[model samples]
Target: MVRTPQPGTHSSTDHDPDTPQYEAGAGGWGSLRGVARIFAEARSSPEALRILAGQNKPKGMMCTSCAWAKPAKPHTFEFCENGAKATLWELDQRRADAEFWQSHTLSELRRLHDHDLEKAGRLTDPLRYDPESDRYLPVSWDEAYDEIGRELRALDPTEAVFYSCGHAGLEAAFLFALFARAMGHQNLPQSSNMCHETTSVNLLKYLGSPVGTCTLEDFDHCDAIFFFGQNTGSSSPRFLHVLKDVVDRGGRIVTFNPLRERGLVEFVDPQNLSQMATGRSTPISEEYYQVRPGGDVAVMAGLMKCVLAAEDAGPGTVLDHDFIATETTGYAEAEAAVRAMDWADIEHHSGLTREMIEQAGRIYLSSNRVIGIYGMGLTQHVNGWLNLGMLCNLLLMRGNVGKLGAGVSPVRGHSNVQGQRTVGVGEKSAHMPADKLRELFGIEPPTDDGLNAVHACEALLEGRMKALVTLGGNLVRALPDRTRMEAAWPRLRLTVNIATKPNRSHLVPGQVAYLLPCLGRTDRDVQETGAQAVSMEDSLSNIYGSIGPAKPPGDNVRSEVAIVAGIAKATLPRNPNLRWDDWTADYGRIRDLIAEMFPDDFADFNARMFQPGGFYRGNSARDRVWKTESGRAEFTTPTTLTALGETPDGQDVMTLITLRSNDQFNTTIYGFSDRLRGLEGDRDILLINRDEMSRLGLDEGQPVSLVCAIDDGHERRVDDLKVTPYDIPAGCVGGYYPELNPLVPLGYHERNSQTPAYRGTPVRVVP
Candidate 1:
């Protein structure tokens, strides 16, 4: 029987000693101090310094923080503040070894905060949950593997789900896919499923390819850049350099977000000695529009409507008719849809007047080359795919895509999220064709559609999924409806987590849970073929090599490739055709297989990896060669302008946007402070507009509870949340993820992509 997670039972109530202080800009002395504080907390070692020096460099490991593109000629100090925190966090000397596990029982560990769990340091050994003792006891690698294999083999292939994290390298991802296929199931749910699955689903329909068409060089030539829902500073701070370059070169940047993100407002590059010395910063967005949460579709449609209106005023002069006629389909339908939308409906939904929308459209019309960049904000909504489709429609109106300095760029999070998808770590086996699998590895993959994150969770709760093998990531914490997930987590028969550090997910153990310690990106991975370097594909499909130089924290810690291979060898029947041993011996063999599987993208895999900035797996859409069924880019007409459905009668609700702190990376909480947002030492706080706070009869620093508006019978609420007034749109509130994830119902997700609507979760505040 599952017990309901009581509200405020595990919430963070203690506030920081200092009051919340909003900084003027992002990535200045504050960023430096934040980084310094983390380093100090980690008790900076020589190994840490070495790892920091090599981060994002050509010869060093890629920053495991975010999937921001790296330059060909990298800067001396290539990493950003968050990147540094991610690196040092991995290189922390403190070890959660046998003693640590013995001292802390599962119940005791569950009581600790997410940040405290992370600070417990690296896992030094393979651990199996001892139910009798209510603790995790260290076990031998072979013993753990044998037990896992026995459990997995006993369960139906369809009952097991393999979850892959984006932080893994291409080699590991490729092997993971091969393992899953070999095991006769395609139940591969990945980190991408939660964040940018909408980008993939929508882009594939519109542009044939599921990746961004633009490269890093596009920022240089782009005359205008439009940012929708992406906070460049906190999510991907390194991108600030690219935006700054555009701003410095007389480019126009238009931003549309609920909050006035400091990064979008202004950025101070820490690398720029002169600017740092003078406390000077480069202004980023020329125009910032604080659109209401879940109103992106309306805002986007209004922009297209304005563009269409302009085209009507002077046909051919405004729109690229020749390109549309030649390179695209369904333009007529898209145009008609935009023209039919009423301005009042658009304004009421978007919380922006006609003049504001037209002004932004005018900027778009004036610019010869434009780049549309967005993040999870645009993708994690009920109408996420529609939001992206509308953005694509706007770009197509002016023929911005398939040209230099122009295209839709989805700023993907995680280091190798794109790479994992590229290598076929997905629920579908379309990338890993059935015939190809049969021919290459003599494996018969499942024909039926596999489970995504949402489905996997449902399966777990319903006792359909027996086992879950995660490569990395805090799966439980990253998901929506934290209370339900927490309750449903133990329903699984077996849970295997291949991880480096401790997190809250590890606490929610299954009936038989095993924690397999794996090598971090910063740790040296020495195989039979000597020190190995893994490759990662960035947000723009740029593949680069990452070689870790630091020694592994423990002798027991193994490479992800090795751990995955071990599981494969243990679970699946012995096949002469599949060389799991050889692949683990030399990851280059895995890359070789990937090259064979994806010849176009990863041809000459090992050789090209050594190149200075790596290689770009060119997008067909970028070259004006569409791979869609119609053999041309297609324009998608949004079905409706109502993004987050109609609010219930007599219910005063605010759309909630889950955010990552400046000191955090994904679910890894480095510290409580979100320096850029002027937040400190608190994670259970909500950022509401001053006017909205007053309307709700709420005061700053007042404790409040959030009740999810979704009528799922079960109450979804998180209590003891502090309300802090912020510069966000009214009828919208912002809170850190994992904490507020409880308020986002699991059933409340995007219709098309099924990505959780983490950004625009409708909820009501109560005393």
Candidate 2:
């Protein structure tokens, strides 16, 4: 007898233990313990250990955690703690095979937490959601593709959304984009839209390109490094070694974040036996400023104001007058805007005194070459583009761009997100021009811009988008307005997921849903030609090869490149111009086509990829060659100083900053413990200032609920959140994302970029 599939539900009252503990520092014995725990839980074998050793090394698989640059001369152990977890998680012995899926009902699987779902192991076969049996049943690859193709062909091309995850390698992403554009639509919503879209959108306006200018080697020559809103320890732990080298060489590091992250304060390299044994740690930040949530704009303006004041006092001592005249434009307006900013307004909005801003300004003035680094903290705001404009203004004041050690660095989350965008996986045709597509492949792609993550969600909810085909990532969980998305998921006609494992996104199935299993970063991808290797691009615009060495658990799983080609072949009408079969068999054909598409960057794609440490895809900004309409860099002046314009009065609201746990990467929860924050066995705890807790008459571990202050008629709330006293700014609170994503309305987003405002969401904490 078939059982009824119950609707999936989430209870806000679910709570784990609220005990928060502490450790000495970020990476010492604690990181080692975390690594050991992950290995033990995975029941890792000696072969798994061999695979871990090859991570981040030359010609080996890149770490799937963050897009941090690989070292030119890598150490014996190039991977970090989180990298180890990601590696082992992919190398797990467990399997969610056909029998395993048959044993568990769809409703029962939906009840499992995201961490538990991942721990259930890698998927071994393609699965089709069986409504009569209320379970996922095994299906052949050809059959699954045929059904998906039929469904896709039946609908308008614009009604289908092709979502690309950051985990996809460059070759796979290229094929994914080629297939989407071949269908004559451009509804490609990617993971970049959520995190660093603002960086791309605003950088194009200011620097003529949407790429960071600095390379990994720039750290060696930098005199000072300024961190705007990134948490190096938790997000990109491997980059901490670069900061340590900077400090060891007499350089300075300045941090501006709302929370005093342990990684930023102190760090002990677990690979260093001397430091690990003695517990002697290297202090990371020379000066740390706890700027308010969404206060980066104010802080950046204040720094520029200080620079202008100093320039006025000394005439031509501070600003780079020559660079401004020859290399840039609109300096007069930018300077006027900075000079007009009120000190009181800057202090009120930034949560930093004038003396503090001046002190930071002094550090900037003293350093000859400065690298400005930031993360999602500056991007996931309503005024995120404005924040980047101000940051660009500050860097331009002293000619920071196109310098050896001075440039903008946005630490990306996914392993190959930037690379995906480089290969034309964006909503717009910025990277893929229509004339080039027509001239090279004789195919004319859609001219109109497509939907992003936010618009995709709205389209799905309103029934405008009929189908969703995801390459990877838990899209349902990663996006904001979770309550609405979860409720409206059933409205779609079809959903197809190409992934390595099961997650919440697969649980919320559409009418015709298919879970197509694919090879992971650690799984060997042997194509028709031979053992295949995929390429990836780091945040610094360096492209390298990644060849997985581990064996696959089953032969049913296919390579992402092959899977994308299979769908394309089954769906699109056969054309003599396209060679889908050859491209699937040999990825070199794809690379050759990519070279033809982006000749300037990928002229010798395959050959350059074989070089040691890979080839740099040279940024125009780094070469001092601005490609703007005016043929020079431009300065921008923001109209507002506050990130999220003035909050309403008489509302007991705190700006809630969504954070990721040290044990987590993006939406994939590694474990319940966040050792750096001294939190264990819980992911539903809120971090607030002690004074704010006292003011609310709440004690540590007190259960409370958060309600969005926006009166959008939607009761966006998360209840039963344990309040823990923390060192965050008074008016700011911190909590993990996806759990609190429900409070972030779909309508509330950056105006120009459309990136969700996940960083500075105002919410009222009620007991």
Q: lDDT values of the candidates?
A: 0.86, 0.86
RMSD for each of the candidates: 5.0, 6.4
Tens-digit lDDT track of model 1 for 1-767: 00111111111112222335454578889888988899988877977877788788787889998999988988888899888999999988899998899888889988888888889989999999999898899999999989999999998899999999899999999989888888878899999988999988879989999999999988899999999988888899889988998999999999988777789888888888998898888888888887777778888898998787887798779999889999999989988888899988787778777777888888998999999999998999888878888899999888999999999899999989989989989888795878878889887777888899999988877889999999999999899888988898888899999999998989989999999999999999998989899999999889999999888989999999999989888988989988878988998888888998998998999989967777988999999999888999999887887567545544376778899888788888888888777877788888876666777788889999988877869899889999887766666788988788888878889888889999988788887
Model 2, TM vs. native: 0.96
Candidate 1's C-alpha runs over 4 A off are 1-21
Compared with the true structure, the alpha-carbon lDDT of candidate 1 equals 0.86
After TM-score superposition, what is the CA distance of residue 690 in candidate 1 from its true location, in Å? 2.1
Worst 10 residues of 1 by lDDT: 1-10
User: Tens digit of lDDT per residue, candidate 2, span 60-79?
Assistant: 88898898988878878889
Give candidate 1's TM-score: 0.96
Alpha carbon lDDT at 458, candidate 1:
85
